[model samples]
Target chain A: MAVDMTQKPILVVKDLNVHYDTGKGPAKAVNDVSFSLRPGERLGLIGESGSGKTTMATALMRLTRAPGRIVSGSVELDGQDLLKLSDKDLREVRLRDIALMPQGAMSSLNPVMRLEEQMIDAIVAHVPNLKRPELDARVQQLLKQVGLEPEVARRYPHELSGGMKQRAAMAIATSLSPKVIVADEPTSALDVVVQRQVMQTLGRLQDGLGAAVVLIGHDMGLIAQFADTVGVMYAGKIVEIGPVRQMIEAPKHPYTKLLVESLPGIEVKQALVGIPGLPPPLVNLPTGCSFNPRCPFAFDRCRSETPQLQEVVPSQFAACHLYPDHKELPPLPARATRELHA
Target chain B: MSKEIVRYIATRFGQLLVVVFVAVSVNFIIPRLLPGDPVQTALARLQTSGGAANVDIQAVSAAYRARYGLDAPVWQQYINYWGDLLTLDLGVSFANFPEKVSTMIGNALPWSVTLLAVATLIAFSVGSLLGARLAWPTAGRGIKSLVPFLMVLTSIPFYLLAIILIYFFAVVLKWFPPAGGVDTTRIMRLDWATTYDILEHAFLPCMAIVLGNVGFWALGMRSQMVNVLGEDYITFAEAKGLHPRRIFVWYGMRNALLAQVTALALSLGSVVSGAVLVEVIFNYPGLGSLLYVAIRGQDYFVIQGVVLMLIVSLAVLLFIVDLLYPLLDPRIRR
Candidate 1:
């Protein structure tokens, strides 16, 4: 899981803030989020639904529509500030530098178009004047890379099976060999076995293209298997980020700990415990820590002051008062001791 | 073509045939059920117009009925009617004696078809383009201003619009002729002068139909375009960095037009019948006016022929639409 730090990052996002004007008020969807992706690095973004994972991804692409706007952010791809690019320039950056493998394979493709047509559209948009035969050859090769037969190019989106569609989508996303690919739950709609196949295809494609990828999903196991590093998001901010092994084995943040503990195990007979309460409404979040209302470790300071994401271990950061930097805060009793006392 | 498409076409064709048959049969039965004998009514009109009190009305009615083959038994007459229909012989008009029903429809069909074709085409193209612009995310003030105007135009009935147009352009300003499809003084020909006169006279009725219909097309296209724009594919297209124009045309309009195609097909099929109100208001020599005259004069044969023609055209139009649908939408191909 070791990544070389000397390599320049392919994509760098800093202080990203996305707000949605829902008429009632502005809801903070993404708040001061910062991340950097090294070349060929796979960064998994894990969060429950409504955690703004998709919104953050969309904002990075500058594809956020009306009622939802990027309030402030700097998305830098290869030293180019994407937020400052013109509409035309942004469009060029989209397919030529950073591509998106959107969620819902069944619906992501234009149903009326043949697979070849859709793929060629993406390819030719950036590299215009590509001759028909050359485009056709490229499409066939891309499809083959995704393990699809060449004849699948003629089939419409509706004709392809769920796995086939996802693969075709992957082909389209990687056809131009962009430096970065942001996939938003690409395998969420597929079955488990198909999910594995898709993930492997994505992994293989990313390796072949050497593209840094932002893999957004809620499945911790999939992220652990696929991503080199994991960023656990909660209510618009990344509460914990570290190497996948460390995040899974010894999560520092209470939310990440709960997420890991929530995964059902087949080897042992353990009762599954759901997160106790719903996420706070973004328009009116609780004061101090956003998670304080639901946090079992909440104390006087935890309820009074918001904690910042600070490094608790080498290369592992968590935003929690339990860390040593917040020495004034009292730590809760250990879980084992509390259970024994109960 | 694939075997599945062939099977789909076959099934649709069979359904169309059944629909046409039912419609034709209903066309025949409905006219027969109307009270009063057509020949008797025709003879009474003739007598009243001539002011001949000494005429034997019953004898004249019997002779006229016998001539028109109405003296036969009901079942026999129905069989003969179907036989004539199958042979493409529409029989004679009772209202206009000795003139065949086919000849009357033949003379009127062109005017109705031409008027509707021109109007609907203009309406569809302009309305759809405007609708698409209005629904576009980047649509500006100019396009937005047309919404209220289009709403008002569409709210007015065809006849009311026609009457207003006639009052302004024909009566008040004398900018165009008030009535008729063409200048009767000039013999019907394909020369420029004749064509100009026809178009000049057609202007108001055409405007009426277009103004009344364009609003619906624009509104329908706008709503459909809005829905299509929200689809996942549109977002995906944007992600691909497609040109705004290409995305609007191929991704947005292509899907939106699917729903509008049915409306277009139905309107095209009914073109032969013409907009009765527009035709009547302008006194244009179209099928609508012919139908009005035929009904008032109690011409059963002409009524049956016109209704049957409309039904057959509608079924054919629907069949064509069904065949072309899979080409536009791949989901239906399966």
Candidate 2:
């Protein structure tokens, strides 16, 4: 969907903090994080496997479970603070204002119920007075919209392929045409072929509904392909976020730069390169920057003081001290970047 | 039902027939295959026990052999046995001569079936519900307290539990009969009073079975439910804005029950064996008690008849489960 940048953000997240209180201490799964999504915008949040992208997505829907509490954050959807809504109102708001297309497509639908029954359940819970014929029609329309055969609604989940299952989930999430959809790694459990199909279906559905989406995944290439705005998350924080083009061609934050460069160019025949050092433990992050221990350009100041997201270029923000000294990120020294095979 | 389900049922019914045939054949062949002739053994035992030294042994043995058709050729006898089984003519009880074994079984079958089946159904329902609630996040402390109590219940044998129940309710409280199916003094009648008396007499034995088996079903269901609650669909169901109750029942308990049903089918054999001990302890007039009394009294013909009934009933129970499983899970319908 072509994002209307001038439109006011349909969903706003402010100072969101979700932590899992372990015996050692709280694992800050989602630290103080904030972002906004314009109407019909597609924002992709990318990170390492445990970079809290999922935590952020789930928090937006206020579906965070026990031990992992949303300590203090306001998820405002269409001016309604979802965090503060009563349980009933919060429940009503979900799937109507904002919905989650869960990560595990293989298990998203109830195994015991038919696809039609599962879809009808979600619709009936929100719009209780709808007649059975109307519900059936809605289910058929939804199935057809997802490019599924009408016969699919009568079949169980086990009967469907992986791509079909993901499409079915998409159909459910957009059943009410919710203004915001939080898709947490929607294609994680699929093969590349099925993954592309599911992603394309999701994009088409988002465009059809004209609803903003927060697409969370670890794959930089996949997310960049679909997102208008790209956010790189590290240690539960959004380290950088900007237009996808700038974020890919000229990444500002050292971590994002290292991440972008790590992707082997299709034209090159060189071995794969990777960022050195693992992601810092969430509970005990580095003294200043969460990425300082892993950054190739970490200076004395990087170890002493944490940097907030600052505008390095027009519409492009990066959380780093390097932005102050240079107009653009300098090339990484040869020894700084780790090459896997060499 | 669709043709797939019909085919599934037909397949299951065929398996039931095979199992019944094997059991009936085994019951028929094992006795005849014994090293010594069963008629000769019965005659020898009767002579020794009855002190009938003056009676002619040959005449008595021949009469007994002719009475049960043991004097016929082996193949003819096997055919007659099959014919007799078809007609429910299980011959006459040795201990209670002139009373047909089928008549005795028919009299006792209803009591046993009602007592055991109803108690088991109640236990399965109550236990499964309790287990689901226990695993549920919002279930109160009241239900949580049941875990340890259930563990304790599971460990104690049912017969011992029956004795303890009889002691408390019948001996201490004088509220129930400690033994027997009904009061021998009361003439049996078709009325509310008779029904109430039967139910009252059934209470301790029923409680013994229910209390004994409930813990197993509850524990089995709890683990299944825990795993089910962790499934992705449960979270999706919650995200669908569906009420927690709806999620708990349809999304949680319904899926968990597939495993519980399989467990119920596998445990039916043990349930029958366990019933034997409970029936003997309560002196309840059922197939189990009949088997026990016949064994103790050396009533060979009555014992054989009761055993065949038990085997057939068990096969029928398994067939019912086989039919039920596909209804619970469509994946099995194929």
Q: Best candidate per DockQ, number?
A: 1
lDDT of all predictions, in order shown?
A: 0.85, 0.89
Q: What TM-score fits each model?
A: 0.93, 0.96
Q: After TM-score superposition, what is the CA distance of residue B242 in candidate 2 from its true location, in Å?
A: 0.5
lDDT of 1 by residue, A162-204 (tens): 9999999899889889999999999999999999999999998
Over A1-342, each residue of candidate 2 has an lDDT whose tens digit, in order, gives: 677778999999998999988888888989889899998999999999889988888889888877788999888998989999999998899898898899998998998889999999999999999999999999999998989999999988988988899999999999999999999999999998888888888889898889999999998989999999999999999999999999999999989988988888888788888988899888888888889988888899999998899999998999999977799998988877788976
Q: Could you say which candidate leads in TM-score? A: 2
For B1-334, candidate 2 gives per-residue lDDT tens digits of 8898888888889998999899989999999888888867875886788744565778656656776587688888888889988998887665666578899989988889999998899999999999999989887988899999999999999899999999999999999988888888879999998888899999999999999999999999999999999899998888889998999999999999999999998999888888888999999999889999888767777888989988888899989988888777877878
- How much lDDT does candidate 2 score? 0.89
